[model samples]
Structures are given as structure tokens and as C-alpha cells.
Target: MVAQRVAVRPEEIRRHNLSRLLRSIHQHGELTRAELTATMGLNRSTIGALVSDLVALGLVTEYVPSGRDRAGRPSHVVAPRADGPYVLAVDLAVERIVTAAVGLGGTVHERRVTTIEGADRLPRAVVDQLAADAEWLAERLPGSQGPVGVGVSIPGTVRRRDGFVDHAPNLNWRAVPFGELLADRMPRRLDVQVGNDADLGAVAEHQRGAAVGCEHLIYLNGSVGVGGGIIADGGQLHGVGGYAGEIGHMTVNPDGPPCHCGSTGCIETYIGEHALLRAAGVTDQHGPQAIAAVFEAAAAGEQRAVDGVHTVAIWLGRSLANLVNCFNPQVIVVGGSLAEVVRLDRVSVETELDRRAMAAARAGVKVLLPGLDQDSALIGAAELAFGTLLASPDSMVASLTTT
Candidate 1:
């Protein structure tokens, strides 16, 4: 023992480098021992020790069969442990709670959905449903390990510092201590995290779907309400109070319909699901089904349908144009149910961006349809959980070990 070099901040550097190494492995998937050493620029001994520790913690596993080019001898590949730790993602939509169990690799293993009544009891009901769903997922995790954390994606502005809901018009929640309530409702052993739904969706798209490798991005959500999420430098821009991506409330038209936020003519006022239905003169059906029917009719070339969708498209374009001017994101991703229609008519949306967005803002900005489609929010929930584990692995481990 040569006194371990008597380093002052060696452990800090080691932890940071370990995190970087883990991120590299996660981003690249399977990597051999030598490949990791070369990519991370860590000495062989250091890399080997860290890899061994990761394996012991079940964060990584060895892959024997090599799926590489010119593989003569079977070299061992280290990869994220798919069966080691799990993440629970919950998408709390306006009318439903979409819950999914995902492994460390960001693959969804199981899913369930519960409807919300949108009344005063909405919060309690949603919490209860989630608790039940968590239990259900816990029962079928398919491994000896437990869920590392619970990540919730909701349709609102989350106060990042305190994990409270600043305002969720659809949920009628105002300044609610969302994270605290949800955590209290949880089994006390699980680590709980909350995020803006649109932000999480952006993470899903950026990490595992269409926006991969695209750093500056704007993700638009078309559901009961319209929302937006922004990603810069491979991370979400949560703003000063975590209310960064509330583009739906952007003033698209001064004389538009009244929004739930007590403002008139917000973007959501003219292009939200309800607004689209009303614009299309649809009243019989409700929720996403009605919106879907409107899109279907538009696809079939119905005049009213075409007009409704076009109007919505124009409003959406204007809202996005504002975002383009503000952030100048490299790509604009349209997601959710309405994104289906937008994908079918990408030319129109792109044309709007070109026409309204500034020259420089529109230069490299490409309008992309939803990558994961309807599964975006679900997968986003999974990504949310993965992020939680990355932040606090020990708390996550404790949470998983309970029950």
C-alpha cells in the first residue's frame, strides 16, 4: 500500500468519471471491456474496477455472444442490466393515467391505464389509481429486483424546486403539492419524481426516438391541451421555476376563445382538442375519441374536417413559430394523437414554419412527426424513471428493496 497517493478530491473525480463512463455505456449500448476503456479514456485497471462495481450493483451485465463485425473469438460485452432494476413511468393525462413498468434499458415491460373523472376528487382518485397500478407493476416486475423509482409525467407546469404543480388547467390543479402528495401516497419505500409531461415526451423522443443526436429541439404535445417541451445541449430546459415549456398558453390569437388559464386567445384556446372539436362543430362525443374522429374525417377529405384541421394547423404553426423565434431549436417534434394528422400532412406544417418563422430560425429547423406515436408519453414516463435513478441511485435502491 503506497498510501493511496494521499489524494484530496480523488473520490469526487472518480464518481464524476464513473457517471460519465456509465452514461457512455448507456448511450452506446453493448461495449467490450477494452472498448469502454478506450472510449472513457480511463486506465484499464480503473475501468475494470468500475465495471466490476457496476456489475455487482446490477446496473450492468456481461454479454458473452458478440454481435459485432469480424467476431472470431467471443469477446465479452458489457451492457446495461435489463433485468436488474426497473422504472415505473406514469403519464397523468387530463382524463387518464397511463402507467408502465420499464427496465433500465428504457424498454416498457408492462402497462395499464385508468380513467379520471376530472372532478374535485380527481387528485385523490389519480393517486389511488397510481398506487394500485404501482402495486400491479410491482407484482409482475419479472425479476428479483424492484423498481428503482417512480417517474410521473403530468400535463402541467411543475415547480422544479419544490415539485409542485404551478398550474394544470386540464387537471384543475393550482399550486398543488403534486410531488409531495404522490410521494406520500406511494409505498414510502419508492423514490418518487415528477416532471412536466411535454418535457418527458421530449426526453423520450430525444433519447430513444426521432430526435436522437439532435441537441436543440422543441417538442409539441397535442392532446386535450397543447403544450411544448424544449431540449438544449442534451438536457431539458426547465426554466427558472420549471415552467419553461408552457407554449400552449402562448398568445396565438388575441381574439381567440377563452383558455382555462383565465386568459383569452391562448394557443390552446384555438387549437386544443376541445377547440378543434368545437371548430369542427362536433359535440356528441368527448375526449380524444372525438378528436380522433375529426382527424379521420380530415383524412377522408371532408370539407368541415379539412377546414377544422387546417385552422388548427395554422394555430399550431403560429404557436410553433413563436417557439422557433425564441429558442431557435434545431428540430421541432409534433407528438400525441393530433400529431398523427400532422404527420400525414407534414408539408403543410413545415410550410407554415417556413412562412412565419424567421429566416435564421427556419433555416435548419425540421418539423418532425411524433416518433413513438401514441407510445411517446408511456415511453417518456420510463425515461423519467431512468433519470431519477441516475440522480439518486441509493434512494432508488432503498425504495426498490421495500416489500
Candidate 2:
């Protein structure tokens, strides 16, 4: 076995400490110098030095508390700088594209959403639209440098090594060099990262949404197509080739309807937006809004819509049963177009899970609606971009300054 390499450089050690400090502040929103010293278990002088370095790098700012106790002088609070380095986050959904410029500490500085016309479904068209939207959003940030990184979230499998979208059945894209295409369109040369939307949704939910603090969780997304992400033991489960969370393709009914992935009876065949609308006997020219209307009809006691929701919920619960048995996740969050449907009739889904899943596993799990709503995947993309900078603040700072 090859020996594990260890980092021993003083700069490397300082960078590591800075990363830890940034993560701590980012996770907690803000921290006082005393709080940072206590939480990080570092000496006060070291904590001060780290905070000073972050302040100098323009990553954080030190401010005094608004109200103070009558005891003594209040410690200065360290918070992420509002005008600091930011990342461009894009969510390229089948029906729409949402883009945002997000700052450190999970703050969304600016955002824009554009619906995709049916004619603009090609891979090149999508990439061009995304590049245009990113440019528009970047232009709105006043007195700021360009984004340090860009993260694109797509509804498909992505190769881990280079951000290539291996396949996006919903978008009719196959083995597309999405990162390269988007990078070419960008005005500036910056690292571009791509990830599966569901996987990124899981990361967002685990870090800042409904599944916060959950060591084991499942994030199920419903869009034009269905997808899922799994977090086991506080880590994402990326199987060989980073396609582990393709829960949409799991066989729920071997004899059911066909899927775009060339598989029959997959969970997506029953619960995806198009499938749900078809089952409800509803027809509309628009996409996600049409699905939302169907769920609204179901809530208002429309027979066709109610039946459609019931059928989808039953199938979704059955699929969740399998996932629960496999991962024993602490929570299962349903998001995207299916969120309202799941929220309207949660009992029916739970009853089905109670029947199909193991009693022990079913008892401990909590099924929830998305905390971040439609923004989960976009925020996850931002998290990915922020992660790159936080991991190596010094280098990231240097790159930003030079660029």
C-alpha cells in the first residue's frame, strides 16, 4: 500500500486552520471571538490571528454587538463579509433555469429565474442561456469582483473527476461536456463545476435545510423527472462513477409504464410530474405550473386529481420503503414539484410506508417537505462553489485578487 501523504508545511497548516474557522462561522451564521475560541478549542491569540487573517482576505468582518450586557465589554462578532468573494450558482432544470450569486455563510446576494421555452431544449441552447443568465446576475452585484467559481446543477448523472454530465435523460443530453461548454461561454476563465441536482439537493438539505444535523438522510426531488440523493453517516454516498443516487430508476413496478431512461416501472414513471399529470387526466401547455394546478385541484377534492395523487403517493411510499430498508435514513425530504402533493396527503404516503417498510426502520424516520422549497438545488450549487474556496482560502484569495 502506498504511504498516506501528510501536509506539514506551515502555510498548509495555517490554511487548514483558516478553513476550519471559516466553516465554523459559516455554519453558525456569526461567532464572537470568545465563542470561536471556545468552540474551536484554540488559544485566544490564535483565534484572533485567524480572524485577522480572514478579515484581511475580505472573507469576514468584525463588528460589535448591537446590545450589550451590563457586565463588561462585549466581544466583537465575526461574520461573513457582505461584499466578499461570491460564487455563481445555476440550477438547470428541464423546464426552467435559476441562477444566483451567493456569498459566504449561505446568503443569496442576487438571483434570476427564466422559463425554458420548448424550442430551447437542446444542450447548446441550455448552456448558452445559462451563460447569459450568469452574466446578467454577475453584472448586478455592485462594486464587486466576478465570481470565484461557478457551479451548475443538472438533473442527471455527472462524472466526478471533471464535471462532465454523463447523461441527462430529461434534457435529452448524453455524455455532454457541459462544463467545457459553459466555461467557453463565460466571460472570464474560472473553474466550472457540475453536479447532479438531486445530489446537490441532499447536500443543501443536510447542511442548511430540512435535514439539518441529520447524519443519515434522503432527499427526493420531483421535477419534469424524479431523482434522489442519499446521505449516509454524514457523508454523501457517491457510488462508483458518482451515480449512486439515481433513485428514480429503481424498479417499483416491473410491469408499469416506461421511463425515458429506457426502463419500465421505474419510480419516476409513476411519480414524475408528466406521469402525475397524465394520470390526473389534466393537459396544459405549461410544465411545472400545470403540475402545481393539478395538486391544487386535488387539495380542493377533485376526484381525478385526488386519485392521481393517491396513486403517486402509494408508489412513492413503496419506493421510500426500499430506500429506508437500505439506508435507514433519519429523515426523507420530498421537494420540487411533488412537495405540495406530498404535503397535501402525507398520511396516505406514510400508511403505505408503514405497510411496506421494516417496522424498526419506519418507526424512526420522519418524512418532511423541503425547507428551502424550489431553491434547494440552487443553494446546493452555491454550497459547492463556496466549498472550493473555503477549502483553500489563501489560494482562492490569490486567484480572486489576480483575476
Candidate 3:
């Protein structure tokens, strides 16, 4: 018995190798067998066997390279199957719900955006809308294999163990078992996963967006509220309870306004959508459009708008300075409404960084917008939906096929 435990099983090794190959193709779109061998550090024969297995599983296909070298035969290229597996990606934002069918290889096939009018009535309605949206998108795939799972991006704190929305101040959600609720509404067989919007956005940007190869990065998602998704040493910076990247709640001002999270002078109150509006002296108007209007006014040389934007820029810079000192990220990708803020006032943000951050840390960091644009969270949710499938490609494909 002691001797038996010492040796690893051959089948386990095969599974691990197969998953590695699939993940590579998923991330890089396609690769030749030689390239796979080099990138994965596996032998040529093993790479061929793994590619064949994936081909048989309908997860990937092999194609001859269009251009051939006269010196020798061209290596076959492996790419994800067009009609292969896909997942439902739901982005629950401050003003709208965006849904998409994201397939293998990070391809977004189709999408739908629904605007939210009433926040108070969202609890039951939101889940129903998500369920219907998933089904609706799945129906339109047209000869493609069905979704493997459902990934929802909510603007709040989520419980990883059970997809519970612990708190979503913007959506007015609290203690909701969001995963189970959506799963109950959809097909019982489909796996439903929920995560924080900012966290998912970070994952998307890291996987295919602005900071693709960088191991250390910070993605600040500023919508109705400001939240952060930090990647340290090539992984998420999830704290003890999976709530580490709450940048909005960080104390940016000691004598600042109150935040929805029951804190005074939090970063969110200073840089969030409302913060921009108040600075511009806009009243009885709200959400993204109003915020954009303020920036437009500033662009038009309105004094109030200019001052308001300048004030917000000072705080934004200071908040970024705090992040730079602690995390020392390689790149800071700003998305959502804040992306616009950075576009209009990047110099001011950098000015604060110059004044507040250490010279060494600030020098290496680059501030950029989301590479995937406004769809980072939705794409990240799609990545989440594909997690189980990517873990064990062969077995997961089999289950998906039979079901």
C-alpha cells in the first residue's frame, strides 16, 4: 500500500497534459504541433497524440498550413472547432445587462444588451432576465454545440463556494444565493457560476486584453462604483474571504463624503459616476450618460465641469498612487466610465502619481484602457463559464456531448 501511493498514475498525467494543450490553443487561437511542443515543453510525439485526442473530442481541429516551405513539409496547425463548445457570459452592470455566447478561443459569437429602468424591482427580475437571455442566446447558435456552463458577472461581493451575492450596493442586492437562483431557472444540467464584475474584468484583460503577457497588473473598473481586480504573480489577489480587491472602499479621503458601503471618504465616493456628476454640478440626472455629459462639458470649456473633472482627477491620481505603492503592478488598465475620465484627464492622473507614488514603482507602470473595450467583464464571464471544460478537456467534452 505504501509503495502504491508513491507512484503517480499514467492516466492522471495524460489528463494534465491534455488540459495544458487545450488551454494553450484556447488562449493563442491556434498553434502548430512544433510550437505546442516548444511552448508546453512536451515532446513532439506527445503533442501529436494530445492534438489527435482533442480532435476526436470535437474540441479542436487540425488544418494544413496554407503557405508551405520548399525545404520540408509544413506542420499541421490546431485550432478550436467552429461548432464546438461555448458558454453563456452575462455582464450585470449599473444600467444594463449584456449577454453573449463566447466560444472556445475567446471568440464572442453574438451579444445582446438590455437596459435596466427600475433598480428596486431587480432582485427576482434580474435572475429571470439572465436565465431567459442565456436560453435566448443558446437558441440562436445554429448547429453549434450547446453551452457548457453559465457565468454571471455581478457588480458586488460574491461567495466563491456557492455563487452567493453577499452584497451589491449598486443593484441593491444583499445575501442573495445568485448562483442557485439562476441555476434553478435554467436547465438543471448546466453549471452556473457567479463572480464580481471587476474581478472578472481583470481576468479578461489579463487573458486577452491590455496586460496579456504581464504577470503583475491591476484592472480598475469604475462604473456606478469603483472596484478593482488585481493580478499578482500571475494569479488573482483574492483575500481570505475572496474580497481582496475592493479598491473603492479604500480610504482616499479622511474628510470625504459617505459611501454606500457605510464608509466616509472612500475612493468610490470620489471617483464613481456620482462623483463626476456632483463635480460637474449636474442634478436630477444620473448614470453613464450624465457622466459622459459632464466630460463633454469639460471638453467644451465649461468652468464648472472643468473644475469638477480636475477635482476627480486629483483623487483618482491619489488612489492610483496608493495602489502603485502596495501592489507595484506592471500595468494599470482602467475600464468602464473611468476609462473616459482617464482619456479626458490622463495628465492630471499622472500628475498625482508623480507627486504621491515612489519613483521606482511609478516608472514601470503603464496606464491604459481595456483592450477588450467595454466587454471585458462579459468576456471574462465567458472565460469563467469555460473553466470546467478547460480543466479536463476530454471528460468535459464527453459529458457535454452526451448531455
Candidate 4:
């Protein structure tokens, strides 16, 4: 028997086209009608109609450049509206939570940050803080009752299917339905999309930051703990249980340090904030500033600080070699606390990686700082918040379905 043929519905086609067009504009920041037509393989009329539809919905704006008038043909440029629909993005690090109202097309409209204290670090307290921040951001949105979506970046393992956080040792959170809890706090039962912070950072970098155009990349994020996100073959490598990229827990030393996860000598134990500080002989200082000061001291050739940085660089390179051998990524982006570590002792780290990594796998890998600086995860959260909107922009006009 022959396979039956069922054509795609016209409405489905329209939704797909609109989704692609909007995403293209979002990715490139701006594009001309002719470029959209060429890139999308759609006719000029179709691109024009889609752009017009998006402009009508206030999701985007199109304008022709004045100087092009001399050429007698000026293609209109399509861009995400600066005042378009927005979403709430939360970056939940171990010590702080950064929240922002991020508009469509990757613009941050308003942001509020709070340091996590002993009591506030608990699940409920975190939820309360996020809920309050959401309310605050909602009040400032443009002509809206709520945001398009909410994206949270957690410094832990998350089961993305249901937004379940399996384990976040740094946050002392375990077996929590964090996504569900945050969703319950929303006014209209808006669903919350939660992801591992490092993973989200990789997404942001792969799309527009350091790893742009690279098919394979790894993002190593250092905070109070280490986390990683891997993009393999242009897609995130999420294993069977969403714990695939937990490289921080990978044991690099069998008898070095005790990790919060009850593991000995995990990579995070060596390169994370606390580890770096302890190595630098700093006792009373904390936060990113203290970490930066350690690097400054190392650069200034302070004996203890220099020794600490060199030690950390060795471990960083060894761990990176392991990843390069396994994934053969084209780019490895060092972010958060580790960014300074890489910047300070790049030569030592490169030497270690060259010694350990297989020649073939090591050939094309480029280790670099995050292109978006400190905002990779935050911007990535914005991308997660926009997922629903990009998938079916029509949902913006209709009431967005709640999960």
C-alpha cells in the first residue's frame, strides 16, 4: 500500500511563515524585504504580507531608508518594535537573582536585582521574590496585563519537560517543581520555562553571542558553582533526563576538595567562586568584586593570588580538554567567575589543553569570553521567554494559552 498524502493546512502555513519571519528579524536585528524574501525562499509579495501582518500586530515595525531614494528603489527594513510585547526573565544564581522585563527583539526594558540571603534562598522565598518582581515588571509593560512569558535560569539541573528541578546543590534545592510554583504565582496562570543557567547561556551565545555560526559549542559558567551548556551539531545536547551538561559535577580530582553535592573534587569545586577565593587567600571578601580583586592581585603579581590563578588555570584547562575530546566543539565560551580566570592565565590553560586534548579534536576549538559579557544567561532567559511567541505569534493576538 502507498502512503497517504495529507497536505498542510493554509492556516498552518501562515503560522509557520509568520514564525520564521519574526524569528529571522529577531536573529538578525533587522532585515530588508528583499533579504527576507531571499533568505526565506518566499516571494516578495509573501514577505511583504507577513511583514505587514506583524506590523499590524505591533510585534514589529518596517521603514524604508531615506538615502536609498536616490537609487529609485528602496527596500523596506523590518525590525522588532522597540515597544513590542515583552517577557519576564529571571537569572537565579546562587547569591543573586536578576529579573528583567525583556521586550521582543532582545531589548531589556526594565530590570531589578536582589541578593539572596539565608531565608530568601529557600524555594518559597525565591518564588515570592520572583512573583513580586514579576508584578513590578508587569506594571511597567506597554499596554499589557502580563508578559508574553517568563523564563528562569537556575544554577542546577532541570527536567525541562515539566520544569522540575532535579538537583541544584549550590542553591540547596532538590526535587522541586520550581517551574510549577512560579507559574502558580502568575496572575493568569502563565507557564514558566526554567532551564539550567549554563545551558541558557549556551543558547544565547550560539544564537547571537560568541558562538554565533558555530555548529558545536560549550558554555562553561562559573558562579558559586560551575555549570555548562553544550550545543552539539547546532542543537542543545539534553540527555535522557536533562542532566547531560552537568559538567560541573564531573570529577576532575579524586581527592582534592569536598563539593556541596557531596562529591570530592568536582570541577566546580576547583573553579567556582568559593574555590577561587579560598585559593587566593581571601577570607572576608565575597561576590564578583572579590573575585575580580583576586584576578587584579594575580595580574599585579601578588604571590598568593598569582599562585592561586595558576592552579585554577591548570584545572580549567584539564577539564576543558576532557570536554574537547568528548564534544569536539568549535567554540568554548568561559563565563561568569571563570571568565577572569581564563583572561588572567590563558597561556597556562592553553598549554594544559594542548597537552591533554587529542590533536584532531583540539584543532578548531576556540576558547573565548562570552560575547554578551555578563548578560549571556539573562539574555538567554529572554530567548526562552520568547519561545512561545516565536512559535506561534498569533497567540499574541489571541490570549496566550497557559500551561
Question: TM-score per candidate, in order?
Answer: 0.90, 0.95, 0.95, 0.95
In terms of lDDT, the poorest run of 10 residues in model 1 is 391-400
- The segments of candidate 1 whose C-alpha lies over 4 angstroms from its true place after superposition are 1-10, 66-69, 391-403
Query: In angstroms, what RMSD does candidate 1 have relative to the true structure?
Result: 3.7
Which prediction has more favorable lDDT, 1 or 4? 4
Best by lDDT: 3
Q: Provide the global lDDT of candidate 3 against the true structure.
A: 0.89
The lDDT of each candidate is 0.78, 0.87, 0.89, 0.88
In model 2, pairs of residues that clash are none
**What's model 4's lDDT at 108?**
83
Q: State candidate 3's TM-score.
A: 0.95
Would you list the clashing residue pairs of candidate 1? 189-399
Tell me the spans in candidate 2 whose CA falls farther than 4 Å from its real position: 1-9, 68-70, 283-286
Tens-place lDDT per residue, model 2, 1-403, is 9999986998777789999999988877799999999998999999999999999998899998878554588889999998887899999898888889988888888988888866687878888787787778767987765688888899999985688988899888888988888888875657788889999999999888999999999999987788899999999999988998998998877998889999999889888887888888886644777887888899999999999888888878888898899989899999987787688778888999999999999999999988888888998998887777888887888877776
Worst lDDT window (10 residues) for model 4? 394-403
Q: Per-residue CA lDDT of candidate 4, range 250-365, in tens? A: 99889978999888989988888888888888999988678879989999999999988988898899999999999999999999978988888999899999999999999989
Better of 2 and 3 by lDDT: 3
